[model samples]
Target chain A: MDKEYQIQGTRMKFWMPKEVDHHKAAALRDQLDRLIEMHQIRELILDFSETEFMDSSGIGVIIGRTKTIGFYGGKVEAVNLSAQVKKICCASGLHRLINIREVAENDG
Target chain B: MTDKKTNHMHLYFDARSVNEGFARMVVSAFLTEMNPTLEELSDVKTAVSEAVTNAIVHGYSTEAQQVELICDRNEDELTVTVSDRGVGIADIPAAMQPFYTTKPEQERTGMGFAFMEAFMDEVRVESVPGEGTRVTMKKCIGRENGR
Candidate 1:
């Protein structure tokens, strides 16, 4: 509930917290799944602008959402990933599943 | 190779998801003595987080248990060991394989061992069925060449 959510028509955007681990991932999975079902969201954008640390659990959250939304012909895209988060994403082969925006020098 | 121990700490906490961050904080704070670079710090934190998570989720599996975390620093090298006395893994090799989680329903990508191995210079796992699992990882900090 502390996480922020934005909805614009069928697209939904979620702002991740400062840390994305198993504890947060479980909560995120529940909330995002509910939103996706209720709003019939076709496009999901996970904004990691504030995330400083993320482990495999973060990977699970993204993968879970990808599968959930993908079934409805929806897509998941990640934006503003920090270098540390990006490393985990790439290392887990998550880059191949969803569209991940490159991190800008100014973006955290 | 001066392996003289510089510092060491041990932590025992309930195997719960909430303590994951606590474990990371303790390890990172302990490593500050070496003045580790941001990258090195983040790598070890991620590796530690993964190990602790596995102990909570897979090892205990909704049962209340204890997770033991041990950290030691020898010169530029830091070693971390996370152990749990819960349901043990029967096959270590299969469990370490990427994307081979036993609990996919919970969205476990089975990448816990992979992340530990990826971020650390060395990773070793020891387990006995019906006993427990211990994951020990070592990383050399302040190295000119990156891992």
Candidate 2:
């Protein structure tokens, strides 16, 4: 809850926790969904540098938000996925739904 | 209660959504002595999360129930059992089938068991309708696999 989620113009960036389970997914979705709707955000960037574990619940969070913003032709991008997290995302077929990219430390 | 031949831990926590992450962390930390690879660790953690989430969400439906996590590990393998005393599953095979969920309204992917099966060496589900459900999973973590 103390983690900061940033929004700039049409782009929004949020940092995930070390573990993205059902508990964390719900709160993250609620807050981000509200921001997406309020700001009419077209792009969402999920930063996963701090995340080491994620389940289908985490996948649900991404898909839920992707659908919310998709109404406005907005897309979701996930970055800094650890190899393990990337494998889970790919197994869940999240890569097909969202843009998966690697983010350098210097680049926000 | 732990046996001398195998190291084990038993956890009982309120079936609150907040404890899902905690359950996974406990299991992951227990497996750390085996020095599992990141991928293996992730696989186990994700599977545990799914099992715990199912217990809290679909099983109890947020009714403030109790969930149990029992972990046992020897030098060769690790086993985890997640149980809940909530509304039990009537048909487990159908439940395990991909894309099938009791709570489709919540947009559940219904891939919880699938991931558990894929990641662990073996997965077993035991449920008695109106009684509860138990999911037991085991994975090899011997020298060849863990190291």
Candidate 3:
């Protein structure tokens, strides 16, 4: 079984699936919740390099994680968002809360 | 409604979350023949996913039920209707309000309908309590031809 996330120091990077919707949101949320509980995570990096499709459910997951980590003054950063995901995020006002970063070709 | 041609399709599937990807794939595939721009395609996919998720989460409350997707394409416009025969919304206006979610504890941002409105050219919602809810959204694709 492939782990859905990886923890590195104070930053936990989550590799989301290609499709993010209501069906997969719950499981993803649970996994993230458990990880947050076990680790002293201060930065949640949502790596969207592998994600092609994201809907409101994806937004829900990000918001939920943001609130959860906000308790510890943790911040969430979204990286490598495709144009489609970026449009949705802009419309949902997510850019106001999270730092949206661009990924370079060599930046794995 | 464009003047070139018209195509229609209907799909019925379980309200499981797994099918959300299925719904997006099917709709995108169906629209491929129209040669929609990437943005146009993504807009439709996002709108469809939001409507379908609402039906699965709010309409059926994640229980075992059925969600139906009906799509109509005419010229450069694609119309999609996602419906579910589950608990209907009592106050649709309230439901459409930004940041008004019934399941906030579940991390629902109450932005489902908002996303639909933002992505699609037109969005219309209708529901009857204890019966079902239907979300109809339309978008003009093929932006290359200046649609």
Highest lDDT model number:
1
Per-residue accuracy of model 2 over B5-119 as CA lDDT, tens digit each:
4689999999998788789889989998777877778778888988999999877765568999999987658999999998899999999997788776676888899889988
* lDDT (10s digit) by residue, model 3, range B15-72: 9877888899999999998998888888888888889888888888656789999999
Best by DockQ: 1
DockQ for every model, please.
Answer: 0.88, 0.67, 0.83
lDDT of 2 by residue, A19-77 (tens): 77777876777888788879888988899989977888888888888888898888899
i-RMS, every candidate? 0.6, 1.2, 0.8
Q: Candidate 3: what lDDT? A: 0.87
lDDT of 1 by residue, B6-98 (tens): 899998999888899999999999999887888889999999999999999988766579999999998789999999998899999999999
Each prediction's total of clashing residue pairs, residues at least 3 apart in sequence or on different chains, is: 0, 0, 1
Query: Against the hidden reference, what TM-scores do the models get?
Result: 0.93, 0.90, 0.92
Per-residue lDDT over A28-81 for candidate 3, one digit per residue giving the tens place of the 0 to 100 score: 898888888888788888888888898888899998889888988989989889
Ranking by lDDT: 1, 3, 2
DockQ of 1: 0.88
List, residue by residue over A1-108, the lDDT tens digit for candidate 1: 565988879988889889999989878888888999999999998889889999999899899889988999999999989989999999999999999985422232
